[model samples]
Target chain A: MKAAIFEHAGKMVVEDVAKPQIQAPDDVLIKVIRTCVCGSDLWSYKEGDHKQAHSMNDGHEALGIIEEVGEGITDLKVGDFVIAPFTHGCGQCAGCKDGFDGTCDNHPAPTNWGGGYQAQYIRFHYANWALIKVPGKPEDYSEEMMKSLLTLADVMATGYHAAFCARVKKGDKVVVIGDGAVGQSAVIAAKMMGASRIVLMSRHEDRQKLALESGATDIVEERGEEGIAKVREILGGPADAALECVGKQAAFEQAVGVLRSGGRLGYVGVPHEDNLNLWELFSHNIQVAGGSASVTTHVKNVLLDAVLKGEINPGRVFTQTYSLDEIDQAYKDMADRKTIKSYVIVD
Target chain B: MKAAIFEHAGKMVVEDVAKPQIQAPDDVLIKVIRTCVCGSDLWSYKEGDHKQAHSMNDGHEALGIIEEVGEGITDLKVGDFVIAPFTHGCGQCAGCKDGFDGTCDNHPAPTNWGGGYQAQYIRFHYANWALIKVPGKPEDYSEEMMKSLLTLADVMATGYHAAFCARVKKGDKVVVIGDGAVGQSAVIAAKMMGASRIVLMSRHEDRQKLALESGATDIVEERGEEGIAKVREILGGPADAALECVGKQAAFEQAVGVLRSGGRLGYVGVPHEDNLNLWELFSHNIQVAGGSASVTTHVKNVLLDAVLKGEINPGRVFTQTYSLDEIDQAYKDMADRKTIKSYVIVD
Candidate 1:
């Protein structure tokens, strides 16, 4: 198998490697169909040649078809298309039983993800519960549509889980900070969950458009004080709920700033450099912190329904899709914001 | 009229003062029946009080009877008993509309009560909404029971509201930090709301006994490291909900340490200091701060139900009471913790 290998720091090269095989009775071999980059990927991508740790493929979001199933795999068989979360849960940890499958100890990510910018394949443990079978393609899932659903395994599912964990309910006025794919997906999720109005803060044009189309009723371009005030102006005060999607200091501040008394703030964006203000959150009585997206628990059912109802067009987030050979250009196009999201088509 | 005047630092004496009369059309003249000392009252009591704003009478919790009602007051007439919160809302403030009448603009305390201890009567605004009518008191109520109900005007109500706001449900394992009147009240509230297990933390045997009698199934006498470990041992892990009843540093830490992954911590204890570590909260996905107790919104109903059913005896909380002439004794009893709470009979 030809796989993208991180030969050394600051470099990745396409090289011939042994194809991934089912090592356990519960493992399933998935033929990579499509995958995209995650923000976490940028951490290594930024470290660029100075550290060590990358041993296997780097990416976590991928949609593929099962090529072979271990004897223990019962729910899925060869040829069934599936969306796989970055890691699979064994479906027995107390956490996994309660829908937090991502935190389960089963089949922890092998310490050998040498490179994420790869195009090959990987086998999953406890494949039945981890690999969600993508039933017959949604009524009209063209290649582009499938690429969009591909994100459901990571970004979309994350956005949705953030809101769900925060307990956002119908008639809520929600404020979403950051206009990335996850932020855009949150707007759609908030709307689908019956929020009366969704306010998104975005200065990026392409991301802003996606937010609007996904159900954002109000869009503000302010960053800090002005941004919070704008949200207050639009919601008539602070919002009933807020989703923090940008893992930046400014976005987290803005997310907490515009909440009404008793309002909840669901934060999914991982903090990188800033310290959270306990005084602000504690005194103001805000409930904060919802963890990462639980895509494994959601990707399958959500995609099937979206495909059936035509309610959401996940593939529209991809502004460009390239062959495995165009990976570098894909990264650059995405980093520069020239594309809402870039996808890599794998066969 | 004679009043308990806080004329200067460390000085409070009974002095002649003007009688209160109705001002607004909905105002009511209350001949205070019982007023209790609160920890907040000690803010001035400990400061050795130089009359704040050239005024005295620092008490914020009181229960009494209606001596007179303004023309617009229809809910009560002369001789009706009532419970009043410290701050009186005009019943029209946005805070009042949202059931957070604690921040009401007009306030419920007497105008003559600009600062310090007092013995006269009070003038209440929007009497109908500002005053809660106590119902079905036993024919001969114990002075202690009356004082306990008086504390409900503040601490007890605050505690109950905190528990309710945190959404403590049936079968939930609840842990309460702080054995003050508020924390004790929270134990009762969580139990009333159907929590299957309640843990109360307190070093004082008296407070722990109160907790056990009220409803707490377990008591953790340890603090810091030992306290947290004991709590986990009792509940088998973090509790489902933690009612933070002590505002002090140690109490806050204990509260945060004893919650399940998706647990909620309702903080009602007013922090005597502001230092905090929000990252601790954010890391575990703990939902902190259920907002200040909206006691005014539930006081009337709680008083009526508890008194009518005899299911709860809030009055046991008051261990001491004094006449208007001996206000100093009441304060001393509370200061020494010789009394869980003390009430001053003002009539």
Candidate 2:
């Protein structure tokens, strides 16, 4: 099997690796059908988080056909088309029961790509709980677009989950920070959740337009204080909730600034810097929270079902796509913002 | 009118001040019926808050009667018994619409008392929105207990709101930090909200028992690290929602430590300390929030009505009472933790 592996700091390679085996009775092996790069992958990619311990396998958003199922894998069978939920999680756990599988103690994670953005074959534990059968769609549906839906395995779910965490409701005024796939998807989720007033803060006009089309009622190009003040002015007060999708410290502060006192804030951005005033949050009574997207916990099968039903068109998010052999270039393209997202055809 | 005015840090005296008059068209002159001390009052009394420029009239909660009403005040009239909702909010404002009136710009405050703890009278502005009529209660309910129930004006409402903000649901496990009146009340409120698992952390066995009786299924007589471990041991994992009622760096961290990854936290205790690790909170995805309780929004009236209707008995919170002349002794009693709450008889 050829897999994308982290070889050294700031370097990655698609190398031939030993095929993964189903070690757990509830595990199954899936032949990679499609995979996509993620922002979370890029986080440690440039700085080498797990590089010291072992080769880090790169991608988390993936889909494939089950090639074999271990003895205890009853819900699925060989040749079942499926979307591998971003995290390997037991369906039952305190965190999973609360719809937060990313924090589940029973979830198994890869020693390295953990079957994420890999090629050929990989083993998945808790297969019955972790893999969702990809629902059938119209014959005209694009396979490339369906592959893009793989982002829902993580990014899209994250954005949707972030919006849900923000408690976006009917006729709510919401602000989404960041223009990445997560932020864009938040615009969609917030709309779907019935937010009448949606605002996006994006410097990119193209992304801004996309956000508007995705149900963002307004856009603010300003950054920092100016950006926040603009949001307030536009809304006549701070928004009901601010979804901080970009995890930078400044964006966090800005999200805090543009919230009405007692408003909720759901953050999905991984912070590049950590200095923030707790007093500000305290005085404002803002609920601040962010971490890894509990995609599996929230909507593992539902999002794919939505994709199959065509209620969501995630394929548009993939501004670019590549063959499995061009996976390295896909990462660079996503990193450089040359592509909003890139799909890798593994089959 | 004579008010207990701030002469300096630790120096407050009953001084002659002009009685407040109804200025706003929707105003009422309320001869203060009852007032109690709150911890924030100590800040002003000690001259801790930097913004204390005025001769600070301390106190933030009180109940009074409508002695007079502005010409346009149709909802209130002479001799109408009411609890002054400290937040003088114009019910029409956006902040008011969101159920947060304390931040309302047009909020008229206690010009007569500055806040709640004081002597004589207060002019309630926005009387329509700033006061609620206290319904008749059983003749058996003692005046002493009634004073404690009046705490619904702030502290009690605050405790319940903390749980409410966390969206605490029936059968949810709750962990409450802080054994003060607010924490104790949170146990009661969580019980009323149908929480099946309530854990209270307090070293005082008496408070622990009160916690257990107040609906805490378990009690952890430890603070900080040991306290969290004990809670985890008690519940297998962390709580679904943790209410932080003791505001301090350590208390906040302890609150964070006891939550399952997606746990909601409502912090009502005002923290004197500013140091809190933003990274820890963000990484854990613990929702952190606090502000002056919007007690006037819904809680005070609801709790009061409940008590009056015999739906609940919230008066046991009081442990001692003293005549107005014994104010100094009342402070000492509460400060020494000799009482769960101390009341000063004014009439």
DockQ of every candidate structure: 0.23, 0.42
Q: Across residues A1-347, which tens digit of lDDT does each residue of candidate 2 receive? A: 88877666556677787888888798898887778877767776667655552474667777778888999888898888777766665768776667766555454432112434556677777778767776553233477557546876777887887787788899889999988888988888888889988999998877887788878899999998899889989998778888988778888888888887667788887666766676676666676766666666556546666666777776667788787778768878888788887778785
Deviation (Å) of A203 in candidate 2? 1.1
How many collisions per candidate? 28, 5
Write model 2 residue lDDT over B1-347, tens digit each, in one string: 76666555555556667888888788788787567666666665455466354473566566666788898887767877776654555667655677665555344432212363466788766778667776543233578546645777767777887887777899899999888778888888898899989998887776777777768898888887988999999998878998888777787788889887668888877767866665566555566666656666755446776666656555566668766545545555665678776665566
TM-scores for chain B, listed for all candidates: 0.87, 0.89
- Return the TM-score for candidate 2, rounded to 2 decimals: 0.91
Off by over 4 Å in 2: A7-10, A45-54, A108-116, A136-141, B6-12, B43-54, B70-72, B105-116, B136-141, B275-285
TM-score for each candidate, following the candidate numbering: 0.83, 0.91
Query: Residues B179-216, candidate 1, lDDT per residue (tens digit)?
Result: 87888888888988999999988889999998899999
Residue A50 Cα positional deviation in candidate 1, in Å, after optimal superposition: 11
The value of fnat for model 2 is 0.42
